[model samples]
Target: MGLFDRKIPFKYLLMGIIFLIVIVLVLTGIWMSYVNSSDNLRENAYRLRTMTESYIENSFQLIDAGLKLYDTAYNHDMQEAFAVVMAEYNGTGGDPSRMDLEALKTAIGGMDVYVINESCVIEYSTVPADRGLDFAVIYPDFCIYLHEIRNTSGFYPDRVVRDWSTGTLTKYSYMPTSDHHYILELGLQSEYFEGERKQPSYSVIVDEARAFNPYLEEVLLFQKQKRLIGNKTYVPTPEDHAMLDYILWENRTSQEVRDTGQERTVFWEVIDLRDPDYAADMSIFAKLTYNDALLSQELARLGVLHAFAGLLLLFFGALVVIMVSRELSRPIEQLVNDVNSVASGDLDHAIRPVSGYEFSSLAESIQVMVDRLKEQIRKCEINEKRFMDLVQFLPQGVFEADAEGNITYANRAAFDLFGYTQEDLERGMNILEALAPEDHTRAKETFMAVLQGKKTEGSEYSGVKKDGSTFPIIIYNTARMVKDGTITGS
Candidate 1:
């Protein structure tokens, strides 16, 4: 058989299909994982944004409440009453003694009020004098209000002031008293709105003074934002920045620029604490920042772990594919090589089975086929030798012919008897050509009768050689056949 006739085993084909299926499954799983992760990221971002918005809104409400309180206390009637009291005390040429001061303190205590004279001197305060000794110096803009009051009669300024104290932004409303040449500054405590609740990390009050001189000593002079106790700016680290940015980008509203060149945008909305019509709003930006920082750290850790696991899985999958292909292909490759060797005429070679049951069965079948082929070849050799020996004894130019009357085999005696050489017999010389013209007719008749299966008695015939020699021959003809039983003429 030709080399092209070799067949591949079923196992190899099955293993290839399995390997393909595994690869497709692995790829599909990875794709699904990627899609899930992306969805999780989007969901996390949206949640963070909502949280930040709520926090910002709460902060805005707190500030708004403080401003409304200042407005309530700075009414025109209150300012006129305070001016009349100051005029009575000044006109009497009275020394504002401790008893008088104590009574004045009692009157203003409920409103958390402070009084400054035309000279920018703080004459009375609800708190002790020492506690507010340099109050005018610390807030020079309050002195300006006193000057404006002294210059104008029955005038009330709609302006307010911000005092940054102990890292807290306090708001105060000022009312001008031209009759007494004084300005009444009403101050509120940070805890007044919330009623002693825990305050936020930072608070910024927007008032008229702050609007004019936005640069406060605590906000501008301190390079660092220290944790309430000292002046220090909070310098975020790289990781902190990443977390903050993630949260802000995810949560905060778009940027908005004001006429003052400042970007003070509302990041969130909540109930307005100062307005009874709306709910309290507060900014928990610091809390949101901390959450974002934590999330960023966790996400980074998860990413690293995912990358490591993916690499490990990739290595494991590759190893599995390689090992499986090698284990399965090795035996099949060997079988193919063995079949090629057999087809190339190496019948003596034996096929060795490997470990698999299928390979073992295939090897046994091939061995049986080889053994049968070898036995058949040996029998053919023996028959050919026997035929040659028999032909050696033939006389009267005896030769084998097929049903077509074409000579199949011619021995040396037959050649000598017919005066023909080996070349003439090998060239398939016609039986008619081998006979003389007179004997050709008789030779044809005898061959025709033999082809019909009739036994022919001894007949005389003339045979010719390659050298044109002719000789008389006597033929005792009978039917012959191939070893397989097909008929031949003789």
Candidate 2:
């Protein structure tokens, strides 16, 4: 039989089936747990996004409020500074080279003021490096933005923007001269306005976000970001620039998964904080990062526990199979031993009682057959006694012999006819041995003719008596058969 079709012992079959069921359950449970772990990761990403986005949004909201409060005071201050510089310009016959730009810088909280001509070139500054710089070539977009602000008569403010050359946070303001001869500017920013701005700036808040949450790996607020942390400027990678561009172009929230030895989920958010008072784009960007190792470890631990539970179930199932198989084998073994006793001709051997009704009925049936055989044997003994008594008085010699020529039974008349005593008959004596040496072959032929139903009434052979004397005798015999049609003797 094929392996699948072969009959297995009850014990092993039961254990195999139970173990298969347990393994399937274990695998299914582990698979489901893994699926839920994926869901948990997404949920954690959302939760982290929700929790951190608020902190980011609130920081921007606070900055927006700070800008409004700072704008009113700073705008007024810039407008007045322009008027004073204009007075100085006219006072020196509009020769900016002769103006006391350093005196004006000290007069206004160490601010560095600049004078940009209509040609968009920095002509004069409190800082000597600001002189003779061409804004149109060095900062074309910023210059264009400043030119636009020059047409407006009111003070305009810009959001906190990073200084490219020095990697510093600088907020600038602009106002046009009534004569429109030059667009005035003022900023000396990194440590210049620290006392006036809001406490806990954007960089500070983002840097501290990781201290509160364990799953949070990193945080970045991209809205007018500070590449410079304290004095060090963080040079971003190409991937960082691409993500920033995607957020700016798509103007929507998005996410990405990345694996760098350790896996992480990055969530991005875009916030619009633009206002007419600002002279530049004011879109806000927030990125929240989370780790994945802890979740994987937890799921792996659950899988191990599931496998352990399956093993425990299989062990218990094996124990139950052994117990049940042993209980069933006892009755069957007893029935087999009873059948063996009957086969050995022990009709007197009793069938023992066994467990279960089926085994008990089988034992009773075997006992009945044994009892019937005993009755038949008793009847045969009685019949043999009557035959022996009848044959003892017969005038003719009567005997019984087997097919092997061994005389098995004989009467007194037969013993006298052969000149042998009952004691001699009790010993082994063949019918052929009772004949003379010359008559042995003829007597055997006549014996075969009798067994084959041939008429041998006149067939004569010389017999040898117990005293070694020879005599002529005629053999008379018939074939004997049992109930099964087997020849017993003649």
RMSD of each: 13.3, 6.8
Estimate every model's Cα lDDT from 0 to 1: 0.55, 0.70
**For residue 143, what is the lDDT in candidate 1?**
50
* Model 2's TM-score against the true structure: 0.61
lDDT tens readout by residue for model 2, 1-490? 7856986655466656665676676667756765686578668756865777677777777776776665455556666666776677778766677888889888877667888888888888776776888867765656777777676676665656555555455667666666677777777465545545636477677765666556677766564442423325466567777787666545456656467576676766666676665765556666667776655665577667756765676677667656776777677667777778877888777889998898888888878878888898889888988877888989988888888888988788878887898778778899987888888788788778777756667667788888888888887767888888676678
Per-residue lDDT, model 2, residue 488, is 69
What stretches of model 2 exceed 4 Å from their correct place? 1-112, 115-127, 130-154, 161-169, 175-184, 188-277, 280-300, 327-490
Judged by whole-model lDDT over C-alpha atoms, candidate 1 comes out at 0.55
- Assess every candidate by TM-score: 0.45, 0.61
- Tell me the deviation in Å of residue 372 in model 1: 2.7
**Candidate 1: tens digits of C-alpha lDDT, residues 6-52:** 56464556555666777677667765775577568647655655544
What does the lDDT read for residue 241 in candidate 2? 75
